[model samples]
Target: MWPEVKIVHGKPTHSQSQGSVERAHRDIEEMLGAWMDENKTKDWPAGIKFIQFKKNRALHSGIGRSPYEAMFGCPARVGQASAGIPHDLMNHLATEEDIENLLKEMEGESNDLEDPNSHGEREDEENTVPETVDAVRTESNEDVVCGQCYTVLPLGEEVNNDGKCFNCERQGNIVNERKRSRESLEKQATKMLKLSKKKFSEVQVGTTVRVPIPDVDRARGSPRNVLAVVGSVEDGLYKLCMCS
Candidate 1:
């Protein structure tokens, strides 16, 4: 009877239930497409996570609130983020600070980094997770974003150290690029298509899936919900279209 949608970060990631909330479901599907294609993460859950985090903190125009803040009354809190993460890495798990530290330590112990027998190339440890940055509503006003801070960065711009701010060249852990990459994908609907894009993927004639929609599926719905066939692809899409 009642409708409910789940929020990842600060945006409506899925319509978990049904209601009259129909406006932009397809858009979310499109987002997932772009993310999976870019990250090449064949794993369904892994890919959705990639896009979910980005949208939570994106700036919103409607009431000027990201879905994250609206859902939980706050912005998205990124636990930890690594730096220079390669796209297709099977064994690449370098941490955020591994950039110079790893390289320095590796070169210090070995003469040739490109050596065949070399054990260390950059960092000695595996990829370390990024530290959590507080993403919340303003201290006094729980609406506007004062700005996010980096955990690793030293205080002030005078330090001339890592985690510098993009706006004022300050210090920070998560860069603007990473943040933007996530936000851009949120506009589309990637999760929807992958999870329930087609027909007959549900339990019965129109079973609801307990999952989140991706970033690129560009249909219409506030949270995004529709009816479809049980496993018959043709029945699902065609019937689902009528429900929408």
Candidate 2:
């Protein structure tokens, strides 16, 4: 006789998932409160993105890394400048020489920018679809003129085959762009982290630096900002002293 397999549960009311979730909820609440106090805004929904960014970039004690790094296998860019960008990405996107060339090229063009919100606004009156241009996508790489202004699109992916570019098509395209941006940022952060480690070895005993004080609050551009000089180096650690 084949006995029916009985399902055994751990406990009547046992759930370990609540632990992480509760901790995350508490952290998010604290962050949201701080942000609201700082900005004087009650827009919780809008502030969620800002909170998520901080949480993702922040280092986690349990994981010994940031959440972004754990998920992407790369360091997260919290708020660093071009010092954090990797050489590969910098070269791939735009090098310093490329920027110089672009500046030189722009020198000949008019100073008037494409600013729509300027004092003297240049409004586009032709908002309606034109009759001559075909809005729908006909082929894989066919050139389609914009129905609104009759301007030829740079690429075929600019508009969908249904002649609707305002909603899903544009939103999906933006999402793809954002994803690529995140990947680039991750690579940059990882490379910069490595470079920063190497830079620590180059620091001499007399090198002066601005040492960040933990749990200290000060106004912007305050005189109380702490400056320290490296006194000694031991086991890859810098012993710093307050600068006179």
Q: Estimate each model's TM-score.
A: 0.25, 0.30
Per-residue alpha-carbon lDDT of candidate 1 for residues 1-244, written as tens digits (9 for 90 to 100): 4368654354455465533234334544677788778877766676676667665667755335566655544356653223332345414546646555655665665666565565453344222212121222133233222234442333222222342344334222224434544555564446546655464344555544444445555345545543343433464442322333
Candidate 1, residue 63: Cα displacement in angstroms equals: 2.4
- Model 2 bad stretches (over 4 Å): 1-16, 80-244
lDDT tens per residue, model 2, 1-244: 5489775543344256686787889989999999998999888888999899899889765545666666655566542232444344445545677655555555533344544454243333233333223444443336655554555655433655756454544445555545655676677778877998887657888988886533234444656558888899898788989836
Q: At residue 122, give the lDDT of candidate 2.
A: 32
Given candidate 2, what's the lDDT at residue 215?
Answer: 29
Provide the lDDT at 229 for model 1: 39
TM-score for model 2?
A: 0.30
RMSD of each: 20.9, 22.2
